[model samples]
Target: MRYFICALFFVVSAAHAQNTTALPEGAASPKATLKDISWMQGHWSGEAFGGITEEIWGPPSGGSMMFSFKLVSDGQVGFYELGHIRELDNTLVYELKHFHGDLKGWEEKDEVQSFKLVKVDGKRVYFEGFTFEKVSNDEINIYAQIGDEDGSAEEVTFNFKKE
Candidate 1:
């Protein structure tokens, strides 16, 4: 029993150490634009959380790239998200809002969750707690640190293939 508990502790710790990262305190956002992440444009699909996830990204336009996401589990609608990465003050910011299957928003009408840019490496764009990695022309991975009502956070990776 002692060995089992110790191994479980390490497993949980390692899970939390997966691909996402948070910005340092007082750090400034690096300059970026929709053009820098235009590679994200396309229809992508993947499996996550015991479900099928789909995302469609529109091409860069008017300083932003819009996207829509949906999750289907057990052949039923799970949730939806609408968002965009837009140029803000010559930098970039990612914003999104969640909705239920009935179109009821999870956030207040005037509220939007936002992530500030951290840096744009060769094939990866790192935001506050989210990162987008391009593996190839048809493959990409998005890592995000998601929080729960209990105030605990976990990193999730969504590996997508372009359709």
Candidate 2:
């Protein structure tokens, strides 16, 4: 009976191990590739609607990108945003979550926003847009409309340089 129990335990352990997926050999580690996004690695400060805004983006675990931003002014909080970026299925994908100061929790989150590289005016540019916001090489814009039930959007432009 003891032998049978031992054998059963071994079988179960082996089965569980086999179900685990492993990364392919020679594939770039996520951490290493995510570090490549270092181009956006910095602390940014800006102003919009009389509020002071700050944003930061950096490498995440397993070759992913992580970002967080917040806006505040006059001792009042405005908004906050967080996101992650990674290359999946041969395409760059981004997931984002946004929250308003008055809201109790995340107001919105989406993972379908994707980006692709394109050549514009002989220069490589990346573009990505979700339901209400769009980002390009030189600018990031949010669409704004009133009383649509979908919430208003705001667009902000950003330019990056190594410091």
Candidate 3:
């Protein structure tokens, strides 16, 4: 009975060690460039459309930043948005996923938008010639003008701030 118990303990311990060793290499370390997105790493709570909206952002799996937005009103889920930002080919890129209330799962809606960070007055960053507007450090104002060939379209702005 003692010999059987000892062998069982050894087998269990060896299995546990093998499972722990399956963790990916470099998973415990973060990259240097990820520091640029440190400003957005937190939980932000706000109100939108008379409902409460909470956004959570964190360092991504591989040196990027993950962003998720959840909105609830009267304890009901309204909508959710998920996205990620990363630097690719010397340009800042953003990919967003959207889901309606009736959708089964999140769907990729927009194309991967790449922007060239143009410094305006050493404080503002502007990325022109895109469907989506610019993102700045001070204020969260997305200015977008769509459905115009002559560039005289309506400006749709969604504003947010640090919380």
Number of clashes recorded per candidate: 0, 5, 0
Q: Write down the lDDT of every candidate, Cα atoms only.
A: 0.79, 0.40, 0.43
Lowest summed lDDT across 10 adjacent residues in model 1 is found at: 1-10
Q: Please report how far candidate 3 places residue 4 from its true position, in Å.
A: 64
What's the residue-level lDDT of 3 in candidate 2? 12
Clashing pairs in 3: none
lDDT comparing candidate 1 with the true structure: 0.79
Against the hidden true structure, what lDDT does model 2 obtain? 0.40
Ranking under lDDT, best-scoring first? 1, 3, 2
lDDT of 1 by residue, 1-163 (tens): 1111111121222247466665667988988888789999999999987889999999999889999989898898788889999999989999988777798887788878788898999999988777899999999999877555444556678899999
Top candidate, metric TM-score: 1
TM-score of model number 2: 0.50
Off by over 4 Å in 1: 1-15
lDDT of 3: 0.43
Q: Choose 1 or 3, whichever is better by lDDT.
A: 1
> TM-score order of candidates, best first?
1, 2, 3
